[model samples]
Target: MRTIGVLGALLLFVEFVGAQTLDSAQVSAIDKNFWKTSLPRHELQWGVGCPLLEEFIIYGMGSDDLSGDFDRPHNWFDKEVYRGSRGTTLFNWSFSYLYRVCKFLWVGADVTYIGFYDVYYDKFTHQKAYINSDQLLTFMPKIRFSYLNRKYVTLYSGISCGIGWVIHSEKKEVNVVTNWAFQATAFGVKAGTSWFGFAEVGLGYKGFGVIGLGYHFNRQNRQLFKRNSL
Candidate 1:
């Protein structure tokens, strides 16, 4: 009787253990629960995201060369010019289009807008400058990978590419015309309550870093296979 009772208990324990719930958070990364998807990988993650940190190509696009061999230090701090180019720093933002491949990865494009700043300081002028790129509305296709998928908060890294079709506005004061495309590298962390409020910082091209904050959005009331807009 003792042997039989012990055997029965062992069987009962196995049954109970098998019926227990798996950690849905961990599993939801690999599987899916209530939330949606993120992009590139093309699964289901719907929320907003941004590149809190990034470097832009504008800085690296040219070597620091401004004409004038006779230019000298009018102040204590002056940098030598290389070519016809100076440094450009940029800030970027992208709305969330969560197309998930799995728990660890997402791919989508950002409606990549930039706040342009020139990076130069001097005893001549200890001031930073913010300039507008001739092209402001561009698209950046990005990939986000989460280190730990914490529903409301996840640590992620993003890389993106840029392209633009722009017609200058009167605010620009010049009729700039043509197609512009930039290839950039960026990575940053995000922290948020919902998809709507998050921030990040990372390096991009042109030897500069960028930071931005924006809300994440759900891809709802919209059709599947709608495709990322250019």
Candidate 2:
């Protein structure tokens, strides 16, 4: 009876050990798969968005001419020239390069361009004044923090601050102004694997809403491509 009891206890211990080993192996496999499908090290993205804030600023500047007579000398003979203005804003275009430094953090740089044109006219005389065409180019270094990271989706928020070069041209006169530029994303979501589509809600230079496509590659593959190209 004692011998039988010892055999039973040994069998139970061996089975328990086997089960633990199997569970550990399965867990390891799952972890490997999870990391394999997550975010990569390098990403390149291009996008277009409406330059809402910039539009407002440009329009405000355009309206300044309507308030007064473009610094014209007031003449008693000059008819009360009612002034008006019109402008058009192009969509903002951006390109970015990002490097993932850790599981939840990324650093990147963005290049953006915004273009618009404004014209002031005399409403009564039906005569047009000078036309102003302006362009804003910005380079910003940015950081992003991922709050939710998954195999096929990621949710994040980011901020960027930098300087912008404003090129203003009117007829033969050209002016360049250096100014502050920034962007703050409240919510951003990206989906897919090597090729992805993303959308963001933000404020500042990038605009209020953005949608774009991106491609991601690992360091080894990138190096291989460089070698093959050479």
Candidate 3:
């Protein structure tokens, strides 16, 4: 009976030790995952988006009243000659650098360029009369709020406001205009780690929809992990 009692005690002791070991292993795994999922401190991104806002402004500026009386009266009955203008927006290119200020906040600056082409044609003849090209460059300070920061996916919204320089060229004349510029991102999603692809739905200089690639820097540090573990 004593031998049997000893055996049972040994069995219980073994089970207890095993449970402790398993618990330790589980805690270690959780710690490792926590470190792995930590956010980076800095990021750089490059993106391209449709220049909807830029195109709208360019069209307004380029669509002047070219439908006045012609330089010379034509044989054809000329009531009021009408000129038609068409505009093509190339794209909005943006590059930005961001610094993580807190767990759910980031601050950054963005540089963006928008290119547009406009052509005016005679309505009756369909002959191209004038060509105008516009280039808009903007520099803005930006702020982002990250709602979800996961290991492989992140969701954020952002806003930026600053000044833009518009260079308008028509024939031999060049004009430079400065104006206020802004972008507001209602939704944004980023997928990946270290290197990632992102998409943003927004308005203003960045366009209505933006997609880009980004790289994270200062992501990992062994010393920091060790300190946190302790």
The lDDT-based order of candidates, best leading, equals 3, 2, 1
TM-score of each: 0.41, 0.69, 0.68
Cα lDDT of model 1 by residue, 117-204, tens digit: 3333432344443222333455556666555455456555555556654433322354544344432323344555333334343433
Task: Encode model 2's per-residue lDDT on 114-170: one tens digit a residue.
Answer: 887766555566677657688888999998766566768877777788988888886
Candidate 2 vs. truth: CA RMSD?
A: 16.7
* Per-residue lDDT over 42-89 for candidate 3, one digit per residue giving the tens place of the 0 to 100 score: 889999988877887766655465355366457346322344554554
Rate residue 174 of model 3 by lDDT: 95
Pitting candidate 2 against candidate 3, the one with the higher TM-score is 2
Index of the highest-lDDT prediction? 3
True-structure lDDT of candidate 1: 0.42
Worst 10 residues of 1 by lDDT: 44-53
Question: Candidate 2: what lDDT?
Answer: 0.73
Where is model 2 more than 4 Å wrong at Cα?
Answer: 1-38, 66-89, 119-130, 221-230
Candidate No. with top TM-score: 2
Residue 188 lDDT (model 3): 85
